[model samples]
Target: MTHLTLSDYDISAERGFLCRYDAPDVELHGKMAAVRNVAMALPKTLVTGRLRDLMLRDLPNNVEADDIADLTDEQARMAMVHYSFLIQAYVWGEADAPALLPRALAVPMHALAERLGQQPLLPYSGYVLDNWGLFDADRPIDLDNIFMIQPFLGGQDEAWFVLVHVAIEARAGKVLAAIPTILNAIATGDTDTVRVELEGMATHWAAINALFDRMPERCDPHTYFTRVRPYIHGWKDNPALPGGLIYEGVEAFGGKPQAFRGQTGSQSSIVPTMDALMQVGHADDPLKAYLDQLHIYRPPGHRKFIDDVRTQSSLRHFVEGAGDRDLTLAYNAIIQAVADFRSRHLQYAASYIQKQGKTSAGNDPDVGTGGTPFMKYLKKHRDETKARLIDA
Candidate 1:
C-alpha cells in the first residue's frame, strides 16, 4: 500500500488526479508549432465552421511515431490533449461528419496514443486531468485559480464545466492520500483509526459534492449539449460515422475503420477509485461493461491504483463485523456520499445531455458521449450503491 501513493500514477496528492507537471512548453518547434497553433484556434475555428479547413491546410503529415515517442511523458500528454481535440473537431466540427481522418491527425495521434496507453481520441485525461493550468502560480488548484488549457469551444460554460471537475479532483486528494492508512487500519483491526479515516473520507466526499453542485453556475445545459458535447462524441455506435473512423496512414488499422469511445466523465478514475475503496459493485450491464472497457482509457498507473484498491480493500467486511455503531455509521456516510454524487450526476445527464434537443449528426441527446443510454444505468447504479450500506 505504501508503494501505491498518488505520485506513482502521475497523480498529485495536492492535485488529486490532475496533471502533475507545469503547463506544457508554449514554444514547440517546426511542424509541431503549427499543430499547436491549429489546436489553439479550435475554440474559434470550430464556431466558424473552418476547423477542418484549417487542419487540412496547416496540420503536418506523417509526424513520425519516433518523434512523438521522443517527448517526455508530460509533453506527450500535452500533445495528446491537443491532437485529440483536433481529431475530434476534424470529424465532428463540420456539418457533415467526415468518415476519413487525414494522416495529418491520425498518424501522430496513434503513435502518441500508443505511447501513453490511451485511446487515440480525447480521453478523461485530456479533457480534465492534463488539460488545465493555474491562473496564479502561488495559489492552490481551485475553481478560482484553475483554467482549462485545451478546449473545443472555450468560454465560461466550457471552462466552468471542466474547472468544476478539476476542483473535485483536487478536493479528493485528502481522501485518496489516506487510502494506505485506512487499509492498514482495517487490516490491523484498529476500529478507531478506521472510523476516523472513514469519517474524514465522508467529509471530503461532502466537499466534492459541493463542487459538483456548481456545474450549472456558468455552463448552460443547452450550450454544453449542442456546442461542447458534439465534438467529444466517439465514432462507436454513432450514426454519423456509422462504421467508425478510418485512420489514414496508420499501419495498425490497415486502412480500416477504428472505433474508440469518446471522452466521458465515466472515464474519470475518481468515482471508480471510490467504488474500489468502498468495495461497491455494479452488476454486469452495458454501462458496467462500457466502464470496464474504459479502464484502458485511463493512465496505466491509475488503472493499477484502482485495481490495487479493489484488491486491498476489505473495509466493508471489516465494518460489518465490527458491531461498532459509530464505525458502521461512518461507513454508511460514505456510501450515501457516493450515491448522492451519482444522483447529481444523473440529474445533470438528463439536463445537460439527455433532455437537450438534438442538433447534429453525432451529438445524440439520448446517447452519452461515451456512446451509451446512460439514464437507466445511472439510476440503477445509484440504487445499488444505496443498497451497499451496512444496516444497523
Candidate 2:
C-alpha cells in the first residue's frame, strides 16, 4: 500500500470553500474593511457591547432583498465573509444570553449567499473550509496556513489549535459523503453493500484517529495546554466580560438577560453527524442532548441539515440485523472510535480548563461530557447482534 500524504488529498473541489475577502486584491479596503475598522476601534472591554447595540438598533427596518442585488459577484462574496465575522463577534459572541439577530444583518446575508451560490453563512464554515488545506497530509502542518479574522493572542501554537479542527472537519467530509451510499444499501436490504460501506466509513474514521495521533508532532502538549488553550476559553470566567457581554433588551428563556460564551473551537460540528451515523436519539439520550444544546451556538440551518441526514433509518437496521460478525465489529469499532475521539477532546478541555484557573461548572469535565452513553448504546447493540449471529 502506498503511503498517504496531504498532497495526495484532492482539494480542487474545495476551493469554493475559501472566503473571497482573503484574496490578495481585496486587502483591507472594502465595506467589510470598514466593519473591521469599527470593531478594532472599540475598547477591548466593550467590543461585544458596541457591536450588539449597533446590530440591534442601527440596522434599517426596510432594507430590501435587492440591497445586495447589484453587488458584483466578488463584492457579494466579500460581503458574506464580512457579515460572518460581524455576526460572530456581536450576536453570537454575546455569551450572556441568546440574542435575536437583527434583520439588518440577516436579510442582507441571505441575499449575499443567494448571489454567491453558497449556503447561508454558518459560523465556522468559513473558518474550516477556507483553512482546510493547511493540513494537507503531505506537508508539515504550520501556523502559516491558518486564516484569522479576529485578533488572537496565543501565537503560533494557537494557530495549530485551530488547524487541528480543520483537519478533523476535512476527515468528517469523507464520512459525511459516504452516508448516502451506506443508507441506500440498508434501504434496499443489500447486506453486502452495507458491509462494504461500513468498512469504508470505518476507514474515514481511522484517518481521523491518525490526525489525532499527529497532534503531538504538530504542537507539544505543554504548548497546547498553556498557549493554545487560552484562545478556546469562553466568557464564563473571563474578567473582561464579567456579566458575559450582555445582549441588550433581549428576553430569552423566560425573560432572562442573555450572555453567551466566548469563542469555542469547532468540535460541536461533528456531534450531529456522529449522532446520525451511530443511530443515537436526541430526545432522552444524555450524549445526544448535550450535543443538541451545543447546536444552538451553531448557525440556524446546521442542526436542520443534521436532522435531515438522521431521517435515513438504514444504519440502525443493519446493526440490528446482526447477520455478520465482521460487519458488526466494524460498526462497533466506528462507534467506539467516535467515543474515544470525544474523550480525547474532554482530556484536552480538562487540562485547559484547569490551567486557566476556571471551573467546568455547567459543562461536564468528564470524558464525553454526556456520560459516554453512546459507547454503552453501541456495546449493547453489538453484543446482542453478535449473539444472534452466532446462534444462527
Alpha-carbon runs more than 4 Å astray in model 1: 1-3, 24-27
Distance from true location, Cα of 53 in model 2, Å:
16
TM-score of 2: 0.60
- Provide the clash count, candidate 1: 0
Kindly give the stretch of ten consecutive residues in candidate 2 with the minimal lDDT sum: 4-13
| Residue range 105-189, candidate 1, lDDT tens digits | 9999999989998889899989888888887889988899988888888889888998899899989888898887888888789
| Model 1 per-residue lDDT at 391 | 84
Candidate whose lDDT is highest: 1
Error of 2 at 39 (Å): 6.6
